[model samples]
Each structure stands twice: as C-alpha cells, then as structure tokens.
Target: MKLELGDQSGRTAIITGANSGLGAQTATALADAGADVVLACRNTDKAAAVANRIGAKARVEKLDLADLQSVRDFADRIDGANLLINNAGVMALPLRRTADGFEMQFGTNHLGHFALTLLMLDKVSDRVVTLSSGMHSLGRLDFDDLNWENRRYRRWRAYGDSKLANLMFAKELARRLEASESSLVSVAAHPGYASTDLQGHTESLMDVVMAVGNSVAAQSAADGAMPTLYAATSPAVRTGGFYGPTKFGGMRGAPGPSSYREVADDEAQRTRLWQASEELVGITSPV
Candidate 1:
C-alpha cells in the first residue's frame, strides 16, 4: 500500500543528519506536511542551508552523534518534540573511534542514538524512528568484541553490526515503552540501496565500486527516505515494525513492511544489546 502522510500541524519533529541525503529529504517532506522540523546536524552551515530552503518551518541544531556530550547537550536544549528521527549515521570506514572511544560506526549509529533517545524520551510526545540498513542481515555481534578490540576489524562487518544494533534497539525500546505503559512507540526503517553520499565516504576503492552500483541499481534518496517518513508518521505503523523497499529483493521499490533476518527477532540478543548499550552510554532504565 502506498503511504501518504496526513497534515502534521502542531507536531514537531527533530531529524538528525538533516543536512543532506535521506535526512534532508525526510525533513523537507515533514516540514512540507506542516510539522515543525529541527535539523539536528554536526555541520551547522549545511543544516542552515537546508533550513533556509525549508523556510520558517525548519530550524537547525548542532549535534554530533559521535560525541556523547553533544548528544546530551542537544537533548537538554530541545524543550519537547512530537517525533524524533534518529537518522544520523556513519557507514564503513577505516577503524576509527568516536570521541567517547568506541568504534565509530557502532558508537554513532547505535550508542549515540541510544543515549539521545533515552535522554530525550520524556520530552517526546509521539514516536521514535531509527534508520537501519539491509546490511544488518550480515551482522553478528560479539559483546566482548563490540569495539573490535579483540579481533580484526572489517569495515563492512562493523557497519553491519551497527545497523543490526539500530534494529534491535528499536525493538527493545518498543518493548520497554509498552511495558512502562507509555504512549511512545519506537520503529526502524532502512533505505534499500538508495543513492546517497554515504557510499562516497569509504575513502577507498570500494567507493568507486559503490558509485557504479549507485548509478546502476540504487533509487533516489527521496525514495529511500519514504520508509522512514512512513514509520515516523503513518498511523498504521506498529510500535516495533520495520519498513523498507518491498520489491526487487528489497533493493528498491515503494516503502512497505520488509523482510528481516531471523537474527533480528532474537529477543535474547535484543535485551543483551540494550543492556550493553546502557552500560556503554552510562544510562539505565530509560523507558
């Protein structure tokens, strides 16, 4: 079924990484739908440009998900919001660490969003949407080696692990909110092979390969952002549902309920990841 969002007047949404790509598209779409949009980004200049294009309905806020302190500060600054889209993320890169010294992908993609969602949970009146990826099927988390400290680090595998964490975090958060009898819902979505700048940043020859793949197989960033927008705004969305492209092996198509790996449904792993994330970010029992 094609999903179209209704008028969102009186709703406020905060989208991370709103400077470009899917985040930008989602922010623009939501603002056009009459929701107040906050472009929470690391680069104020780029975010400002987007906000300008979005006119008065959009504003910019500086946020660096790689830095836990930045996440805390941003959470503190926002009074309240109806929706929070945890859309900012880093893909495959050389073994690097976040400001808090965790693996960059896992730190920014999962932990940072984890902390931000918890810190801002009380203030959010509606739902939380997190961006995951199709690559999450390839992820296998080793709690002991989550940071790649005990073994060799493969950039793609690390990225997969982070995306998997994003999916599990959403599910676990949904469970907690339900258990706590809160109205808030948590959901996740993936951009199936969308052409975006995320592929151009590997700083390696894979960039060339991905560029070719983008030109040949990927959909537009706006199309990729649809699943996220659907998750964020669709009244039909379930608390823990995952949406994505529903055709061509989930590589590109209209947004819908998409398939996920069996591993993603592991309740034990979801609980463990949530616990581990809480310890890593120094937060507890957020829901």
Candidate 2:
C-alpha cells in the first residue's frame, strides 16, 4: 500500500503555501525524488527556510492567494513546470474579504487558484493538482451569494463551499482539457484529518478545539500529504480523479480513490461555476 515515486529529475513542480504543513511535506518529498521544486508562498521568509532545507533543487517565490495581483505576479515569473499544485488554503474563520473584496475563504481557496492556473496553463506541461476536503460534502453553493454579501455568514459553511469549489474546478478543468485535446490533466486530493497550521488560523475558540483534535485524532502532515503526492505524480491517477487516505474512513493510510459529494459531479453546476469563475476572475479559460 506504499506510494513509490520514480525518478523525477527532469520535472519541475510549483507548490503554493509550501512554508509549512502538507505543502511543505509534499515539496520535500518531490524534491527528494529529484524534481525541481518551487515554493510559491506569500511568506517568502518561511518559504526560503524550506527551500534552503531542500537545497539547490528548491527555490522560493512570492505568491499570496488572497490577492489577484499576487497570483498574477507569481504566475508571470514561472516560465514552465511539469506540475502546479494548488495547495494553499484557509479554513473556518470569521467573515473577511480579500483585496478584490471577495469572501476570504472562497476567494483565496478557489478564485485565486482559478486565476493562477489559467494564467499559467501554457507554462504547465504536465498536470494541475487541486486540494479539496472531506468537508466538501457539507457545502451548498449559493452562486448568487458566493461572497457572503447577502447571507448569514457561517465560517464552516464558507470553508466547505470553497473546498467544494476546489473539487468542482479540478473536474471542470479536466473536462475542458480533454475537450481541447490537451495533454495537461487536472486532479484533486484531500488530506483528511491532517494536523497542520491551517487549523490554527480560525482566530477563535475553535482554534483550541482543532488544536486538541489535531493532537488526538489527526495524522502527521507528512502522512497527510501522501494523497497529494500520489495524485501529482502517480501514473495510476486519472484526469479528474480524487484521492485520499484509504483507512479510517479516508482520514489516514495509503492513498487511493476517494469519494466526493454527488453534487460535485453535477455537469451543469460545474460548467456554471466555471463560467462564473471566469467572470469573477476576469480570465478566459485556456482549456
């Protein structure tokens, strides 16, 4: 049940938010496999520390997923890569807005990656891997109020919607890539209950709750990242496929096919979300 990575000497991979947690674990694993790794993160200092540890094969780049300009700027500097992992995200938090004035979670988790992937599509020669969540099943998208502008804002629900959007975006991108006859593939993965800094940003009592949960019920960030690495590099992965841990209800174990909410498979919704995302991000779909 172990996931083995073959020679990746010729590959280049860009991973967002690689300063810590699952992103850092994924970056280290790939670099160890001989891939050139780019830690595309907002915090250059932390990312630099990670790159330094990975030695000459890794480099740090500034990428703030909360701002579109940052996303664009990050994409502009990337000449090419074999993989682009849309791995950065925020979890449940009090209502907030991005620089573009979109809901913080939805904006950063989905639209930000949306714009970056499209902007860098031509530069990515192999695949795009997006991170989703087991919590996606609890999400119900109100496209009309995606930004939480007209509704009661619930932090957990907002997080769920964003993660659901992540899954939807990956599948839609895969469909468009196939239709365009492109070699690039899009796949999705989830960490299940990974213990990471991501859960500490809630800025509320839940932070303490999640911290306790992490100590008691979560897997290590390295183990949690296995699904992402498997999706990014595994030949067994299919376009639009989702992967996660195979044991303890998909929370921790070997990587394998993972179940997603049925709503995530709705074709019409996927297309509609894609169209709306394009309009929101002001980018035409390259696929």
Candidate 3:
C-alpha cells in the first residue's frame, strides 16, 4: 500500500530521532511525499547521513531530547511545522538521570518530548505523532515516584512507564486541541517489534532473546514505520487514536488500532499528567 500525504508539498515536518530506525524511515516516506523534512537528532553526523540519503529538502539539526534547554533551542529555530513526529527515544538503558536529574528513561522518553511538544505547539498546526509502544500496556504511571529515586529501577519497567506516558501525552494533547478548536491533531503509533539499534541499550538481556524477537516477531524498520506514517498522513485518522501492527499480538502487519490500556484513557490521570508535565517542562500549551 502507498501513502499519499495530501497538500504536503512544500510543507515542513520535524522528526526527532530521525537518524535511524523507524524515525529514519518516516523521514524518507515524508520526503518521498514531497514534504521538507527536518531531522532533529543528537548526532548531527548520523542525521546528516539520513538527510543525504533522503536527498534534497531534508536537513539535519542538533537536538538532545534529554535536555529541556536543547529542546527549547530546537523549537525556537523552527516555525510553522505541518507535522511533528515525536519519534526520538531511549529504550532499556541503565538507570541514570537527565541533565535535570530526572530518571533518564522518563526524562528523555516522555518529559523531553512533553517539553518539546509544548514549546512547538503553536508552530505545529496540522498534526503531532508520538511513537508509543505495546510495552505501555504493562506500564502504570507512578505519580509519587516518577523519578525512580526512592524505588527500584527495572530497566524494562522504566521504559514501559515512559512509553505509557508518551501515549497519555498524545491523548491529552488531542483533548486540549479539540477543546481549543485548534487545527492541530495528536495521535500515536508503535513499531511493535521492529528490528533496530535500540536493542543495543538492552545488550545485557542476551542475544538469543533479541535475535528470536527480531526474527520471529519483529518487522523491518520501514514496515514498522507504516503505522506512524498512516497516523501522520491518513485522512481517516482521528485525534487521540493509537495505531500499530495488526498481526500476531501486535507484533507485525498493517497499520490499525492497537490495544491500549485503560489507565492510558484515564482522564484524571491525563489531566494530572498535563499539569505535571507543564510544571516539569515550564512550557504552557497554547490551549
């Protein structure tokens, strides 16, 4: 199936973590659809390579999602983005903290995107697509211990929590956009079990686990990216919707509604998350 990004010609899109994996694929697809793509990444060289591969109209920028200031800097540099793809994220990395001292996974995977989204909200007039995960179903937000400083830190659990936060943020953003009657739309998609370098963060887990998952369950990065592309481009897409692979336990196949957690749809929790996110990021949403 092919994607038609209608009216995308000459439009600009900012894709975080566009240097590799699913983000890179999305960048390519958007470029192919005639959108001018900006590759926001920590590694400028890697991002530049992807931009070059995608050809002209694709440019690279330096961005560190773990630093709020960096996110602000990146936001300040751009104006009028038709699409914002919050695709940059870290996986099961060792316990650490962001530049602001929050748990690294939570800070980078959720809070950073939170800050960036708010900072760029006014400029993002069309849509915002966050990369979420199936692991979010196993996650439950920890309001009391968001940092994991006073609690035990299991890598996967922290990753799961962050992914859940990503979905929650998208859902909440959509609600706010609707309430304000803004043109912006918010949606989310997961890559399911896409094979990518993100596994390097979990090297301690064992190659057999990674290999089996990649071979039996994982889709190619391009294949996994289709859902996000769909959410970003499809006319049938609805705000606050979640999309992912439709095959075996959501491990592969075409774009469709993926199973989401009840907690993710909790309005009270989402509201609290919005407030906490605003306080943490110190950026107010336009809504």
Candidate 4:
C-alpha cells in the first residue's frame, strides 16, 4: 500500500473500533494528516489512550454497535463528520447473542454497523468506508434466517455472513447515494492478514490456525490499516470499490482493487438485505 497520504485537513472522521488494531492505526494516520479523528469505541479507557497518542486533533466517544440504543446515542452526540469509517467488527466465535438478542457476529458486525451508518448518514459528507474481509468469498447470506434463529449456528459461517453483509451494504449504499444525488460514496476494504488482539480471543482449532497464519504471513497492524486508509482517503476509490492487499493471495502487499465474491453481485439481494436491515434496526433511513 502507498504509505504517502494526502492532506485531509479540516475534515472530521468517526472511526469505529478505534481503540486498537487496524482502526487505531488508521485513526493515527488520519490525525497525522490533519484530520480530526473521533475514536468511536465500546471501551472509552482504551480509546482515551489512543486519542492522547493522536495529539490534540483526536477525540473519543462511546459507541457500542451491538446495542441499537448505544448506536443511536452515539450518532446524536456527534456532528460534522466528513467520513464514517465502519471499521469495528467481530469474528468467529461460539454461539452468542448481542444485547438485542441477535447472533453476536451478525448483530455486531453487520446489523450494528448497518444501523450506525444510517443514523450517521446526514453527518457524513465525503464518504463512508465499511470494512469487509478476505473471508467474504466463503460467505452466503441466509436472508430467511438472518439471525440463525431457525438453523444451527456455525461460528465461521456467521462471521462470513457478516463480512458479506458489509460488502452488500457498501454497494447498496452507493446505489442509494447515486439515486439521491448525494455526495457520499460507499466503499469497502479488507485488512488482509494482520497481527492484532482480535486474534487472541479464539479458543478453538481456528485459534491455532490463526496463530500459525499470523506468525508466518501476517503483516503488522499498521500495514494492515493501509487498505482502509486507501479506501477512506485515496482519490482512486470509486463508488462500491473494494480494496485490499494484492500479493500472497491478498494476505499482504500493496493496497489495490481486490476481487469480491459473485454472491455480492446480486442487486436484488442487496435491496432485500437493505430492507431486512431497516426492519431489523427499526429505522427508515433517508436515501
């Protein structure tokens, strides 16, 4: 990825999950480029530390995507954001429910960010960058059972579904923006394999696999943050564009356009996902 960053002075950005990992690195880089970076996080203590390191141009706000109320409250408290970076998410884990009683990964990763983006729509001006994953290639959205309410939960599949939703949301939002003649363009990015704390919580065979992969091929968190930065700030990013590392099976290298699953190409399904998201989140967002 290009390490060179263009000037983004006077722009304000809200980066979810900015407490650590790729989010934190992205926040730091944006701040260094003179953008006001808001570290939206569930953990204010960690966020505060990151903000301090980011110098005077940084601020911290509490944002828990897993809770609709939390997302609403966070949106209301902020204003004048030129960018909304949907960088927070969860990965494979045992079956669990969020505060809203939806599957944990689906709730926090897709629905949570889905609701947050709409609530934040009016506040953003330039663009919104939603983070997906390389694993989205394996995802299939079960629209009939979005929460896995009628099916057995598979942790990896749940994670894949959420990531796929991220791409779908990005594309759908781009379409809406175009239809409404809005200035906002929705883009997606993947960090590839990055070594971060997100890997420390796995307690299954997948944990060992993640450990081995990171040790052998993963880049540092700073390197991982580049594709997100590119999507958020690069002039080359187009509406519905997806960016990721381009070498080693997209696990590491320069940030560039990356391939998405054919599953993400269905516009009808994107519309359905949008409708389902609005109903699930209890809000009718303006296009």
Among all candidates shown, the one with the greatest TM-score: 2
Models 1 onward score TM values of 0.98, 0.98, 0.96, 0.97
Whole-structure CA lDDT of model 3: 0.88
- Model 4 alpha-carbon drift over 4 Å, by segment: none
Off by over 4 Å in 2: none
Q: What shift in Å separates residue 249 of candidate 2 from its native position after superposition?
A: 0.8
What lDDT does each candidate get? 0.92, 0.94, 0.88, 0.91
Q: What RMSD does each model have against the real structure?
A: 1.2, 0.9, 1.4, 1.1
lDDT of 4 by residue, 1-287 (tens): 44777898999989999999999999999999989999999999999999999999999999999999999999888875999999998888788899998899989989999999998898889999999999887788898999999999888888899999999999899989999999898999999999977776657887888888888878999999999999998888899889999999898998999998876878999999999999998989799
TM-score of 3: 0.96
The residue-by-residue lDDT of candidate 3 on 1-287, one tens digit each, is 45455667878889999999999999999998889999999999999999999999899988899888898898888876889999999988888899888899899989999998888888887999999999997677778888898888988899999999999999999998999888789999998889987776665755558867877767898888889998998988899999998988898888888889998889999999888888777877777
Those runs of model 3 whose alpha carbons end farther than 4 Å from true positions after fitting are 1-7
Q: How close is candidate 4 to the true structure, as a TM-score?
A: 0.97
What lDDT is obtained when candidate 2 is compared to the true structure? 0.94
Instruction: List, residue by residue over 103-125, the lDDT tens digit for candidate 1.
Output: 99999999999999999999999
Q: Name the candidate, 1 or 4, with the larger lDDT value.
A: 1
Worst 10 residues of 3 by lDDT: 1-10
